[model samples]
Target: MRGHLPNAARIIDGFHVVKHANEAVDKASKAEAGENPPLKRTKYLWPGNESNLTDPRPEVRRDPAKRRSKTARACGMRERLQDIHADSANRTEAEAGSKALRSWMMHSRPEPMKALAGQFRRHRQDILAYFDRPYTNAILEGLNSIIQHAKTRSRGFRNMDHSGTMIYLTCGELGLNTVTA
Candidate 1:
């Protein structure tokens, strides 16, 4: 498709990009948790919003005396990545944000985070496309979820025709009220 549509803008979904960073944090947290009994039940710490840390669920909240660990540092990095998206106003800003994030992740100790950074570096152009036009696949993904649910409820369709019709009925904004009964 890229070959045929050479002029088309390539946009990567922001959600998927953030998901990768979150996964890296999760991996680090899991590894740290294995050796540290205190972190055993702290899996929720990395995935939750930074604001949650101040008023977190009883299980995940950090004690005042306990110093922040490498997992916490990884979580902080994830927050920084999210902030880059939220704060950037244009492509130039996004480029700077991406550079900062890449540099930080490159030096990060977590292997997963370093791998994610490498991915960002390789796909830098697609990732930066978000700033050029703030578009996401969220709507399509939502509609897909609805279609999948309908398919599951019906125990799967026997043919693509049935599936396609179901998708259109559920997702297509057809003005049925204007049609005659």
Candidate 2:
């Protein structure tokens, strides 16, 4: 991509990165739940809501079981990484915070999270570039979704031109004011 667009700013969408981190946490949690019955059915509790969590009590803090659980640890690390995005005021700060998170993940017990950390390390610049550019392909994705919906409605267009026309009619901003006779 850089080779084709030499001047374009390469950025990894923060949304997808966080989503991948959540997936890693989910995988860890599922595996942990198989061994620890208490962790079962708590899948939804971590992936999305973990970031909103407040500090744990000092007593829970002292519990080795809670601290040693791979899922718990992964969720904690994922939450911490999300905090970097929420709290960092500038690119430098975001980068620093992400580096710290990456280091933490590298040493963490969860294999999935360790792999995710490696991905973050490999795409460090592209991921951190998001702090500077703050751009995502959301609009393009929305348009693609709309087009897909149009295609599904048609089932199968007879020709390429028909498909293109359908997409244009569905997605184009055509101002069709009523014409009186």
Candidate 3:
């Protein structure tokens, strides 16, 4: 589409991009956990917020050594990336954050994170565009999920129109009293 619409701005959803990084962190955590006995039942450590590391939960607070492992480093990277996304108030900040993320990814020990960094580098421009608009397809994705659930609960829609109506009723957020009036 970029070839056909030269003037159009391309944007990548920040949430989606960060999900890849999170996946890498999870992978690293699983690998590390498998090798270490203490970390065996602590799979929840990696995906948790950085603050959760100090939480009162025995699983989290009990293991200081777990926080020093390679998985922790990967989780740290994930947390930093999340901070970058949250801190970017404008395009310039976003650009700087993206650069920092790229640098961190390049040095990251996990192969998956390195590959994710390469992907971000390739689409850097589109990813940066997200700072300008701050819009994401998350809402659409949620609606799609709801529609799928609706379809599954009812077995299937008889046709396209039925499916469309189901989706509209589920996702349109309509006021029935007003519509009836």
Pairs of residues clashing in candidate 2: none
Q: Sort by TM-score, best first: what order?
A: 2, 1, 3
Best by lDDT: 2
Score every model by TM-score: 0.81, 0.82, 0.77
Sorting all predicted structures by lDDT, with the top scorer first, yields 2, 1, 3
Q: Give, for candidate 3, the lowest lDDT window spanning 10 residues.
A: 53-62
Residue lDDT tens for model 3, 1-181: 8898987777787688778888988788777777777678767756778565564654563367876777777777787888888887898988887798789878977676787789889988898888887788777788888988767665565787766665666667755553542
Per-residue lDDT for 17-99 in model 2, tens only?
88999999989988888888656666766665533445664344336675578887898888788788778878999988988
* Candidate 3: clashing residue pairs, number: 0
Off by over 4 Å in 1: 2-4, 53-67, 155-164, 173-181
In order, candidate lDDTs are 0.79, 0.80, 0.76
Q: Which scores greater on TM-score, model 1 or model 2?
A: 2
